[model samples]
Target chain A: MKRERVTLRFSPDAYDKAITYHLVRDYGLVVNILRAEITPGQQGNLLLDLEGEPADITAALSYLSSEGIKVTPSERQIVIDKDSCVDCGACTAVCFSQALLIRAPEWDLAFDPDRCIACGLCLSACPVRAIHSKFSDPIEEAPPADEA
Target chain B: MATKTIAEINEKIRRGEAVVLTADQAAAMAKEQGVKAVAQQVDVVTTGTFGPMCSSGAFLNFGHSDPPIKMSRVHLNDVPAYAGIAAVDAYLGATELSDGRPEYGGAHVLEELLRGKAVRLRATAYGTDCYPRSQIESDIRLADINEAFLFNPRNAYQNYGAAVNSSSRTLRTYMGTLLPKFGNVNYSTSGCLSPLLNDPYLRTIGIGTKLFLGGAQGYVAWNGTQHNPSRPRNEHGIPVGGAATLSLIGDLKAMSPDFFRAAYFDGYGASLFLGVGIPIPVLDEDLARCVAVTDHDIQTTLFDYGVAERNRPSLGTYSYGELKSGQILLNGKKIRTAPLSSQKKALVIAKQLKGWIEQGDFLLSEAVAPLPQQATLHALNSKDEVK
Candidate 1:
């Protein structure tokens, strides 16, 4: 089984389609919605964790692209600047997923990107402005290829 | 009971025969070999804490300008500094926020200054006969300043309560963010390794007491603001909650940016993360017992920050042992716990202070006077308004 994390951005026009339902029923992919920001008639984004055969995941991605849904790999969503972090564990107060933690005995702050759901909560909790979210700003689609 | 004086310890230190240990090490040793035995074997016990201390700032003397001006209003990098004193002298408070940016404030400016970075200095003054220049703006580095000293009014709180939210909404506070329904618990102070907790009675820590402040030698100037030494204590004489505080003074020019840092809470404001360490002389069994406090022996109250008032509701009392275990039972539910204070850095400070004492480079000081053991907090009466 193959597991992957990806961000799905839906334009306003793609709001009516049942994206998650189609991915599960047609493509035979298991979808876990890590986070979602969807408002009716407005552009929305979903951070998802997909698990299935590699071929099935690829087919789902192609299907999403055909529906005009932008897919970006969610390889690293949270970035913590080690030089600025004081290991105070303030970010852990808001981190429900336990992605950011203070290791026992040593008391040093450790971050696990795999556990992070990209909630963007730690970005504000950091005192020295050390934590940042790549998805904090709205994802913008690439400009249409210039007509020849 | 074995006893040792500051002078005697200093003598041993100079002779390279003194035995120094961090509070953690000393506490463990005392636990294994009773207080009396440990007191006879150890010469000094050092304690340290690195946490958010909002009541901290620096006083700077920016030397005279070519055309001098009695700076009535001063700002360092847009954060206002109190310039009501001398011509070029000003005090920058850690909590002072900039006009445009709330996150960037006095603490950030202080950190920048310590990093040896040039900061924008702006001041305006009423024209005078001897100092005619009304306004001046320039970039100034820490090297350019004649003198810069940290004169914090309050720091190294003896013991503080853990904060939690019992309400339905999240609250942003200096204690860090608290989730609703006791979703998480946040506490500051280095517990067993905390300077004040180790010297709970203020015996070895008082006016003239030498200490490691932000990587520089500093002195206890006075009893810090809101210093309530009369706070209720446990069997060990340690306060159950926030109690005695210290007013510290140190040379900022010798401070390291590593120990002195700027911090910001999401919706709250800016504050300084200060590293403070104090060495306690093993005067006698009493002093030795005090410094032997451990996480299990020290107790702190958990306060509900959902109230949003000076007096918050207390959830319950728990030892540092339970809190540091990463979770505590509140209302029969397991609530995850986190610390706003950096325990790792506090240990580092304690170890550094121990090294200095072992090398005979740092010596203990006798307090000039004892801090008051009886003091009460007075609340402001809003009805008494001046006409």
Candidate 2:
């Protein structure tokens, strides 16, 4: 039987691979053990694709959540803002798993969540303040209005 | 101002509809499309900009007859709408036919005319700076019932040249350059650059021509705003100005078959081009200025921008040579690639590789292809291992 894969999606702004990198490095999760995919996006979000034993997937989720990696049932993806980003040309180095890439000198940075082993080493390396954690602090929902 | 549903608005238009939905009505419809609020109260929908509007006309021939089909303006109209946005004018172009019908001639005329053409529409309701949508809608509903409300290009062309900028000389020159052709045209000289970009309702109007001409570099910050500075200038190491941008207006008409083209002119304050369309994205104005450079020079620029790699996303297994070679074979077989080239197959070899790269299944290697000279990739993964 084919093992079912758990899918997750980060908020467009939360698609930072740095959080994934941290999960991989500190959590001992194998970046290549699962699938990471960038979905065809109108909003252009990066998705993480992973598959393994149920325990392993659970462990991956735990680690991802601890690192603030946002996961959804829909996709494992990150959204990149091309304008606010400055291409430091650095994220190309730490991704031994080959998940992060500098597309070209002129274009801003891009991350291949598929190749990313969820390693977070590149998180600190980015100088331009471009990269972000997939799971940022959850936004507080507005309190229910008083129904006098 | 309560926004109206698309059905209600369409119904009004259908039912000899003079009912102007309140701003709220329009905003609510816009909200369904992920827009928050209609920043401007104009019901007039403006379209996004066209890319490759520059240079496409320069090197390539769109195949128009020599002396390039003489275009003349038949009519122009400056219309006032209740939508709170500035009055818009439409220009129309009709071929001078011998037997009362146009001699369906060349490609460029149809192409360029359709690309930049805008027709003037008739609107009746007019009020001061503040007119509630409900009031406007009721007024329009009550006004004289003329089924002819849509703007025609001919009327737009006639009045567009007459719009007075701060100075008559500059405005006259603007008219002279554009008026000669008289093809369908849509341009706003009211200096309302900011609204064109941020207005949710206008932005949603998927089909319509809109252009913002003359403004400052600072305005580019707002989405969808395109400003062409009056001179060839640069900002933040990016060049802005000259006929570079003016030339692009034609280029966009030449390049894309989809969507009408829009142009913006902002005085020299910034150096960059910002455009949003069916395929929305901002391309640096400096790159546009590179139109002055040769193909080789442009290729060099593309290399700097990482065009070869970014343009072609792939994983480790595929190489440019193999893809090209595959094309040759497919060509011999008369096979077509789907979306990518023309093999017309699901999951081409290169796209599969790209899937792998994105999925973390493989490492991209230099074996794929030699990095073009002046190429650079700024990956965000620190552990990026180039295998």
Candidate number achieving the greatest lDDT relative to the actual structure: 1
Model 1: runs farther than 4 Å from truth?
A9-22, A38-44, A58-75, A138-148, B384-387
Docking class of 1: medium
lDDT of 2 by residue, A1-148 (tens): 1132334444344454575565456545444324444433211223344444557667667665544434454223334444433332334434455566543112234566545544454454332234555522232231222310
Residue B13's C-alpha lDDT in candidate 1?
A: 95
Question: Residue-wise lDDT of candidate 1 within B1-387, one digit each (tens)?
Answer: 687788998999999899999999998999899898778999998888999999999999999998999999998999999999989999999999997866898999999999989999999999899989999999999998999999999999989999999899988999998989889999997989999888787878779999999999999999999998888999999899999999999999999988999998878899999999999888999989988999999999999999988789988899999999889998789999999999999999999999998998998888898878778677675777674
- Give per-model TM-scores: 0.93, 0.20
Error of 1 at B301 (Å): 1.3
lDDT of each: 0.90, 0.26
Q: Give the per-residue Cα lDDT of candidate 1 at A91.
A: 93
Tell how far residue B50 is off in model 1, in angstroms.
Answer: 0.8
Which residue ranges in model 2 land beyond 4 Å of their true spot? A1-52, A59-76, A79-134, A137-148, B1-49, B52-387
